[model samples]
Target chain A: MPEAAGVSADLSIFALFWQAHWVVKIVMTGLLACSVWVWAIAIEKFLLLQRTRTAMNRFEQAFWSGQSLEELYRSLSSRPNHSMAALFVAAMREWKRSFEGSTRSFAGLQMRIEKVMDVTISREVERLERRLLVLATVGSASPFVGLFGTVWGIMNSFQSIAASKNTSLAVVAPGIAEALFATAIGLVAAIPATIFYNKFSSEVNKQASRLEGFADEFSAILSRQIDERA
Target chain B: MRKALTISAVGHAVLILWGLVTFVVKPLEANTTESLPIDVISDSEFTQITAGMKTAKKVETPKPLVEKIGEQKPVEELTKIEKKPAIQTASAEPMPIPEPKKPEPKPEKAKAEPEKQAEPEKAKPAEAPPPDPALEAMKKAEEQKKVEDQKKVEDQKRKAEEQKKKAEEKKKAEEQKRKEEAQRNAFDPGKIAALLDKQSPRREAATGDTINQTASLGLASGRSATLTQSEIDALRAQIQACWNPPAGAVDGRELIVRVRLQLRQDGSLSVDPAVMNRGGHPQFQIAAEAALRAVRRCQPYRLPIAKYDVWKDVEVTFDPRDMFRG
Candidate 1:
């Protein structure tokens, strides 16, 4: 009388899990995976970018305070953590290699520095960009993937109705609902991936610019040291 | 780093809060499967049977009754012939002696053969003459006559019994009708009016005594508040029935309002402005005022219609806390 027993009319657990067709289940699973992946990238990139920015700031301060190249290399190599400093050491080593073979002139030094700086910029860009393509792929493609699942799910729902000869809302609503969930998950997966991708890329570009600026300044210091030695 | 952590913490908190809200207020009891079954067959079964019969008839040939009868044997033929005579006798008209004579002749023929066979040796040729045939025919006629006469006597008796039964039923119905009519006529309008008038004063006196007793009791109880308990209860019931609290009254607000009033003999209320206390909420003040207005509009209140002293001056408190707290 209080509507406690037969009145419950709960959707069975099997029905809840199997409400979506197999295709929809797959799509939702994929969307869920994508969402998790995006969140991981967002968090990982946040940490990586934070670390790089902090390290770059410290390295720039040390470099500008007139520490010798050898001393700076030794200190930075000991830590082996700063991405910007690593790039600097690589470029400086290459410049030193190119200078070792050449008659050491202003023109040769200038050319070597320019080439080293370009290579360093490219290497730093690569280091900053690890696994970023995956983020972009997820951001750009997840919505369409979710849309595909939704459309496929809806189609299957209609097909089921045709097979069962039932056209009622109860017969068709569950499948459609499951399909729409895929699209909602897709958007959930896409939005943050796109946001973090943009944010990390910008931060990487900022770090690259800082590294390039530091290279030019370091090259000027090197030229001054050479002139003072002469 | 600290700012980022704080922002993340706030974001997680909001997301968790929304998730909890969604869970708590989820549409758990939706009637999604409240639809009729797909394969309803009872209504279709009749149609299907009818259609099946129609198709069977279209495909099958009809059989003749004569052919069906010929399929049965010699015993069935004799039984049918015997039953035909009985049926003819039962239904034959008295005026139509021709049909009855036909069956009587057949019986005579059969009797003659049986008589000849049984009494051959003792038969007197001259004595077994015309009288014998005539006597036998007369006896058969007399037997039929006796059966007809008995049936007539039975019919007459049945008619007489039926008439007696009908007469008794009619008499009973008339008696019942008279009793109902008498009952309807028993309540005289003038007497009823006099009785009602007689009870009114007694009711008023009893009510007045009750009021006086309650008022004295209230005074003696030593808590001589501005209103009596009976009056408070009545006013509370009235206001409770009248007040519809405003929609979306926020949670965690103490929404109690107390209104004191002066009542005239006619049950009209003049709210005591000095005694009206509006608890802190501004909305509570407005709601209390509205409730008071509702009470005034619902006047002249039907207070224990006979008693005035109990409800002469009353204080009513309106508390919306219970209604809106959840």
Candidate 2:
């Protein structure tokens, strides 16, 4: 049987945190908060991006399923929450508003519809990218914050040296370990946040381009229809 | 959106719970120490018991036994009581056998209490045949006085021995001073010049002799009969075993000390080692002392007799740069 000494040794991560100085403790707590926020935002954005892609695919299929624009608009139960659906609805609403004022006022109808769609696209992209700045900040700033913690911990280690008048490795190893743990946690918070922020930013860009392509095609179709009526 | 928000909130809650478990709750569990209750008697209770014993002792009168063992027994003499039990049992065994012979002298007493009182009086005499308590006390006082006198003699002898040691140390220091003075007086330039002239031809021949010896031995090419790397390593190992440098001498730049040794043909040091160069710092002094101690402890090195001229007056530099201190 193995000895129970391993469990009794005060060298666990939790023990290091418990033995850390107050400033180091604050640093650790901040890093932990950053890690939590990074994970939460990553998960939320992942779900949101997946839902947006699915909604866009479904809306595009409906738009190209030989169903009339009025039929598809009536089929949607409420104002669409996904970016692509919101963009389509905003453009269609502008089209309907222009028609309500004048049926054949084709001078600025396409421009007005394009302007509304552009505004809605920007709004939807902003909604899609909510909480991503937190990820970027955590990725860029956590390491320096952890470095500050390590410097503080090492300073404390030197203070212990002066107070005890001994420079043995046993006297200072735990302090250094606690300090390095801060840096390790910072890296842990940073790496995934950085990876996911880049990934989510690219996904938003792809969605925006797809929405813009759809908007231009829809405006072109409207322009041809106005020409036909005139 | 609602589902995603709920999922994010749940993820945050789980992460927070994990952090709390590892940092707070688990640490608390690990830190929990089992406290045992110790029974401590109060000071008042101890004082009361001591007071009761003092009163009880004052009320009781002393017994009138023929041999009171307690007062007559010295602390050291009590150690003998452990050995006396076997002798007591051996003597008691013979007392029962002698009971029949004693019945003739005390016929009326033996008949009145044949088993108990007659045998006990005879057995008591057999067990302890010592004098009265007052007489024993006088003898014990004399023995204690003898022991005290012996102790005083031993203490005087110890003092004399200490004085002798101090005188011997002083004599050794004076002898060392005399030897240093002799060495200073013996440094003659004329003798050194004559010896160098006498050994010059032999020194040239010794180089050829070393070349021939190495060639014949085939140990290694370019070898000489002088101190080789292996010999130096052996010398270093011997000295290192004895070198106990002072603690916290980590900085090496200021701790180097150079000493010159003059060894005889038989490897015994011919003259006192002279410190050639020292840093003049206190730490350097400590290092020099340590190096000198090492040289002293590992004296009478086994040097090659043929290469005595090479190692006869060698300069050793004590450098502790490679020593790792934590």
Candidate 3:
């Protein structure tokens, strides 16, 4: 005679995946999705910030290379520019508009330039930070989701134990291992999302400040031009 | 967004492929009860954790049986037959000399059970017994046959000292216990075993626990071992399952049958079990034959290999009264 046939324990990954409760399966699937989405957002956001930083470098080089302000503005306003170029164009547009009519509105032209630049800087910062909230949400919430899956799996295993009435390690080991797999996947998804979220948020802040510094310098250059024209 | 999804799919595919190649765990007591230190290596250990056959090797294989016996007894007990020096007289109550060879150095690894669990002390006890009957005689006959034959006893003492300095003391203690036990048991042969079990728990604790039986109860050189009460009960039950009491044999005279058995280490009969008191009555012969058949049918008994010496030669009395759990 031999042991009862009910307790056949297999702990392979695929077996674990298929044998787990539906709740745990769904949790694992969702964690995997979070992983994918986090990586995607990280990639797109990284590329976006890199592009803006380079564009700002090019725009700053053109502005300070002894080129005329009007010429720089003309060239940039004609073509789409991000970050520093966009702020320069918005400010120069208001300056150009004031001088167009016989009664040039030089009375509030600096204020208008500052207002437009402020709007452009905020808009550019908003673009650079797109999809980052998703990263933060996934990072913070995924571990808890994984925990839920583990709880559900453990509960399901206990139920099976009660049903079978066998307390052998063979009876319960596979189930517990499968249940813990949900947590494993969850940790995989959560760790990277958290790391990237912290990294991207800091990069976004640095980019915003660079844009602001450029805007301040550009306004100073415009103020000199306004004094010369007046 | 779609390109990100494609890249994510690729990454996931690599992860899953790695997982399929590597990530796994194993369980204890599924097939070999053989699980420990699992990592990213050896997926096969984790792959086939098939269960339910943990104890399947214990079933008996039947064999052709019986040395016929006739008219049986009222009540009988199991008797151990001490051969050669110990076989002085059948009626002279053969109190066992506690065979000197408590341990043999090696057993050429049994096929089904490859137990290498013999600790270092087993070797220590091997050379202690220069007086062992079978395997030591054979080993001595081989090692010192043509050369240094008379120096065999002196060589054994030297070897025993070399292996373990405590061998002399251990042997002295064992001899003292066996002599004391043998002296005490010259009264009754049947009560000796039960008395040994009862008295030993107290007396042997003061003496030592490593009172090993002859280790080579199997095919090769070995040590001694003993069965616990539960294990003895299991062995008895296994035999009883195969036993069929002769239906019409009634009365106190035909109730009991004592069979003297000589079993090899694997639990099969080394020689036909001799029925000690076979009378010329037909009903008694049926009872005796039935006992012999049960003994023959149960082959390769699941006695512990560690305790091989204790059960190597056991006398079982088949009584229709106790349902053979006795």
Lowest summed lDDT window (length 10), candidate 2 chain A: A1-10
Best prediction by lDDT: 3
Query: For residues B161-209, could you state the per-residue lDDT of candidate 2 as single tens digits?
Result: 9999999999999999999999877768877765564544431122111
Error of 3 at B188 (Å): 49
Fnat of each prediction?
0.03, 0.09, 0.46
> Which candidate has the top score in TM-score?
3
Give the Å shift of residue A151 in candidate 1. Answer: 1.2
TM-score of chain A in every predicted structure: 0.82, 0.92, 0.93
Q: Please write out the lDDT profile of model 3 over residues B97-186, one tens digit for every residue.
A: 675655554444333123433445566566553354576677777676546655866898888778686777789899999999998868
Cα lDDT of model 2 by residue, A17-125, tens digit: 8888999999999988788778778887898899899999999998988889887766663768788778777877777777777455768878888899889888988
The best-first sequence of candidates by DockQ reads: 3, 2, 1
Q: Candidate 1 chain B — worst ten consecutive residues by lDDT sum?
A: B61-70
Judge the docking of candidate 1 as incorrect, acceptable, medium or high. Answer: incorrect
- How does candidate 3 fare on TM-score? 0.48
What are the lDDT figures for the candidates, one per model? 0.62, 0.69, 0.72
Instruction: State the TM-score, rounded to 2 decimals, of chain A in model 2.
Output: 0.92
